[model samples]
Target: MTDHAGTAATTLGISTAGLDLEASVALAAEADAAGVHAIWTSELYSMSATVSLAAMATGTRRCRLGSSILYGVGRTPLVLAAEARSLDKLSGGRLVLGLGNGTVRMLRDWHGTDPSAPAARMEELVTVVRKLWRIHEGRVHHDGHFYHVDITPTGDVRPPLRECIPVYLAGVNPRMIEVAGRVADGLVGHPLFTLRYLDEVVRPAITKGAGRMGRRAENIRITTMVIAAVDEDEEQARRDAASQIAFYASVKTYDRALAVAGFAAEARAIREAFARGDLEAMTAAVPDRMIDAIAVAGTPRQVRDALRRYEGTVDHVILYAPTLGLAAPRADRNVRRLVAIATAPRDGAR
Candidate 1:
């Protein structure tokens, strides 16, 4: 692993794009062998991330396995705690539990939950999950605006053998980042985060939350998953990235983040362009500034240089490669390319 200023260098991880489960596990094992630090499986419209990571743990010995994100509203806190503990044991204590307040649409449409009280519900869930994991026996109780859980630990229940599993809260909004710094072990900085946003919005919110608990800034891990694509034809890579940006521009949550990144007007334009099905206009609407702000796609060296801007601020960098719903061979090639870029030495330094 590369070292930076006596700190264990930040390492690369991959985000499984809810595609092929078997291929995801194999690719994770390949990454572990290639010296990548971690592999994160995500849940959107497929198999549970916990199940996927459990399978991945059995396949690899060294790499840490985690959930890139699991929606907080769908599962009860106790259930989530149990799953996290089980995965921790199965991975020999290498599980990172990542949670998120899912998009408003997901809550309203998919889970049939109330989006109005989501933030409060999410906070209550985190508190309950932490207490459940830490306490061996007792009735866990909380009086939040939404989701109050009161349950006694069964006599057969046992505490986790590990001290604490790292919990990452994924959010880009100011309030969410603040809560993450206050309650979670780490912050999963949103995919749309830019250096300006990190410096202006995230850092201040994280500091505010950390200060509330008398904690220091360094206590929280800041990690981000960037949309990435590396190819000989850089223009093709850019086009692929623009497609993703256009999709996100239509989403309300991402629109707010884009606004925070000083691209609100551009994002609005892109959204308008996308709705018209004018492919050229959609691509044109994604300005160079927007592309540089959210994604890292180009030649390998160019990608690395772009990533370096985030090195000191982010403790981990999860590369969200563009093979989410693709065929196995294509996805595997994407994974291999990411692994190569991440593990490659810079300036010929060993």
Candidate 2:
């Protein structure tokens, strides 16, 4: 609590994963009351991020609200723009519209959409959303390679609460991170990201893309998820965190996260085990070194120390509770522990 990290003031957030709708909203309210910097929701197969945030918007007055990611091709640009506008107004303009393109298999199988050029599709999608939000007149139309739109309102369209709502792009790879720099207000990094990767690869890509648009790199904020599995039983916490790391490592979509951190061999091990559907072996593949580098797990003191390592690399670090093997009660307990870790007293109190 005494600026042990000694870098900058930390802004902490919590993601409501592995929670039911009612429980997630309650957590949001609790996080808001506890003065967490932000409250984020990740969109998986269920639980609409926008919908959950809408309910959270009603209960929260202080915490900034967003999705860690809302998939790009899941909805049309107009629909996305409309949802952002609605949520922005609901939260009194505190919305950070975080978007992502689902993995190739997910895109094709789940959403029935093609993933031929996801980065390009995402860039175009952002462009269209911005243009649509700013348009106040009768006719609205866009003919893009991936999306097409033409709409003429019978009456004047209601002006958005803010013409420029902050859009945060989710990036695990350079191309997506670059798109974020070119257009997004912020970039959301994966839980597996390391400080070295952020400095050496992520930030530079942002600069390159920002340069293309004649914009400064520093203007784009960075928010990241830090998987935090807290339990008084230290061994249990480590196992839970490792399970999460193993699951992510198995996915080829997140290969860059491991590759950039020189965890390629470990990832291969996890992948092979994943193919055989051997959960235990996959979990076993994640070493303690990997856990220490990417997540915060163990006793309260140890978790806090691990979090300090991320202070300077991220503007907001969302405490991601590992849920692959956690029961509801234990997961909720971890969330509360995270809240305590985040709001603990620091020397540079402000």
Candidate 3:
């Protein structure tokens, strides 16, 4: 499908998947030069995605930057707003802020932060951040269920920001989706999904949420993160996808996605295998059917065809190279190939 401007209707984006900081920054520069629509980074106990993006901002001339998602708990709302404002100014107003509730395991175990009523906290965070951006006089103060702050007029407080940064909420469940619809500019879809689950489960949930607020669902942008591997060696592509899916299944936070795809029992088995330190079993247990439903793999044409399933539903495709536990060179090649395939035009589209 072509837009009125004669370009592809849905733009292409790339996710820098927890690569080393140097490699990630280099990829951001390359993706920007190659005319990719956006670049997103994940923040899961690795190099901070925000810091990586800060480095990318200096090297790249175009290509909007985003956090595939940054967790909402660790930083105060004021700190988030300040960083976003600085980054937006540095990037010349090309930043999309994607926020999420970190997994319970990470929030509780690693950060020792409370992991209760996450959806409410996210709502409050969004509210506070926007309020900070809009403030003109006096201090920004919020008396919310999760937070309270009264920043008096100090010499350190910066002037009110002019850019209106877009906020996209990362959600997998119903209540989170409703919270996203009620407050966010967009919703971010996870990689562990089938077109069936997206069309049936995810879309309806967002629609219902939007309907409650008397908002049209179509107005809410949906940016989908999809696992992709394009290679002449079809077996290698599938193998990479299987390993990645198994890893995702091991995370209890993603069980809802598996359940939506009719693989709840398989997910439990994968988790059990993961707990027993049997990663091979986890990969093997990922049925080919599950892989076919979730990942876009194989040859370039094949991958493009698979991605068309998301054409009307997703406003942007955040292509992710999921070659977990693979050798570095091999994984890098997979990412390069997927980028080429994802940015290419549809066959015979002139």
2 or 3: which has the higher TM-score?
Answer: 2
| Rank list by TM-score | 2, 3, 1
| lDDT of every model, 2 decimals | 0.77, 0.85, 0.80
Per-residue C-alpha lDDT of model 1 across residues 138-205, encoded as one tens digit per residue: 67776666667777667777779787778889877888888877888788877777878877888788
Model 2 agreement with the true structure over 123-192: per-residue lDDT tens digits: 9999999888876755778998988888777766799998698898988889989999899888888888
Q: After superposition, how far is residue 205 of candidate 3 from its true place, in Å?
A: 2.6
Query: Considering TM-score, which of the candidate structures 1 and 3 is the better prediction for this target?
Result: 3
Q: State residue 34's C-alpha deviation in candidate 2, in Å.
A: 0.9
Candidate 3 backbone collisions, by pair: none
Model 3 misplaced stretches (Cα beyond 4 Å)? 1-8, 154-162, 347-350
Q: Please report the candidate that would top lDDT against the real structure.
A: 2
Model 3 lDDT per residue over 75-136, tens place: 89988888888888778778889998767777789778888888888988998998877544
In model 2, residue pairs whose N, Cα or C atoms come closer than 3 Å (at least 3 residues apart or on different chains), thus clashing, are 1-346
Candidate 2 TM-score, true structure as reference: 0.94
